[model samples]
Target: MAIIKLSAIERRRLSAFATCLVLSVFAWLFTALSSQQKYKVKLLAVFKNSPQKRAFHSLQPDSIYATVQGTGWKMLFSRMNGDDNKISIDLSALENKNYVVLSTQLKQINAKRDIERQVVSIDPDTLYFDLSNRLIKRVPVRLVTALNYQQQFAQSDAINIKPSYVTISGPADVLAKITYWQTDSLILNNLNESFNARVNLHPPAEGNLTVLPKSVTVKIPVDEFTEKTMQIPVKLIHNRNFYDVKIFPQKVKVTFTTSLKDYPDINEDDFEAVADLDQWLQGYRVLTVRLTHMPSYSKIVKIEPMNVDFIVKK
Candidate 1:
């Protein structure tokens, strides 16, 4: 290949020409973008002001198109940035009419946007709905939680939710199928103290259903646990034949953990330890001690004598 080297003066002239060419292109672009232009943009449709007598479901997509007039720069950036401007549609008309003209709402929709970019027209001009009989019902709210407690710590009482029920309004067929609404998961880990906060409910999965008061207050009681030991008398069962049975150990030490607040309330009377005499018929020499009843909140630590030798005389 042949190389043609330019002199320093020639190189300087070429650099100046390149700079001017770049500046001209930028100036032209600025002029073009400053002029007013019209373009299309996607606006999300938000339905509100639903009629009391009717429940309706939209048959069209949740988004609609708008022809907007604005400066070229705004139009270009609006498309590039994918702005999510929303237009709220009133549903009161559904009480007497089945269709809504979007053009009739152009003034309100434009009011939500910048004055420089006004909506000129709406595509498809009208919206239609599937009508149904509306029903309103009050339903219980179910709390959902995923909680992990620190060692020696546990929930001390029943969880409480303010406003245990919520009112739901929707199509009669839909509301008839819903007995209870569930809150979003309340997740906590390594919890050592009581919890109190407001949590959101799961949104209605169906577009036509609506839940009032989207959130609720939740309170959970927690406390540190301590071990308690008691001497529980063992009772024999299945001795219907009136046979006399004597076990070597008449009592067993029951150790369990209960919340500090509940420790004083729990007693040996709340627990029952039993040995089934029927086991002897199966040729077992020792009777296994089993706890037939215990407090629901207590966690058993150990039973000192899990088995005892017994003598059965008919």
Candidate 2:
């Protein structure tokens, strides 16, 4: 490529041309923006001063459509400043009434914002609301968690949740069927050490429901694990007192995994297996062996035999 160097006079002339182009663009922008026009905008409207003693209330429409008349610059500036784009309505004076918000109220909202813009029109000139009696009840908070521990690591203590209960207030019909408030599902993966974390509560999917203390703290205690084995006697369950029943190989070896801190405390008594003789009475030759009980902090890993021979003795 060949380079053509410009003389000082030529460079000055080029600079002057670029400056004029910028000035012309600015002049046109100023003229266009100085003109006044009407603009339709959506504004978020918040409810305040809800009716007294009414604990549960819902607004029909939480937003509004208002037309503003102002210079393009003023409108542009106003849109950039979202703080001035909000409207508030007071409902404290409502007396168990369904309200129809009129355009007059919307005009007042525009004036309150003092946006230096004329209120032209408000679409959907009306809004509605339904207010009802409020009822409060205490409900249990259930923890939803998917916890996975690394191999040979286990939870040492019970999963702990602070503030295990939550108070909910809503319409009576909505609260009647709610037995408990459950937290949003939480997941902890590859957890090998004890830790604490905060989780949020689940909001009601619908209706005017309010849940207090929308979060809870979870503390989990994790520790190393060890393998343990025990022999538990199999109990025979039946109503045949007139006949002698026998389940050969009555004792079973139960292998389980438990935290090292808790392994020593576990015993055969902590586990239970049952071979229901009722199955034999029902005309089946064999009986199924099932683990009916086990230590809470332990997990059963293996059973010696899953089935037992059911023989009736004379």
The estimated TM-scores of all candidates read 0.87, 0.70
Off by over 4 Å in 2: 1-38, 55-59, 68-88, 95-128, 154-158, 203-208, 281-286
What overall lDDT goes with each candidate model? 0.89, 0.78
lDDT of 2 by residue, 1-314 (tens): 99999999999999999999999999999998899889988877666665545654455556677788888888888878764566666655455656645565656566676556766777666666666787889988898889898988878888788898898886788889999889999888888899798889997764357778999998889988888888889998774675677777889888888887777788887888999877876888888889888877777788988788967776
Residue 48, candidate 2: Cα error in Å is 3.4
Per-candidate clashes, comma-separated: 0, 0
Best by TM-score: 1
lDDT of 2 at 310: 65
lDDT of 1 at 133: 85
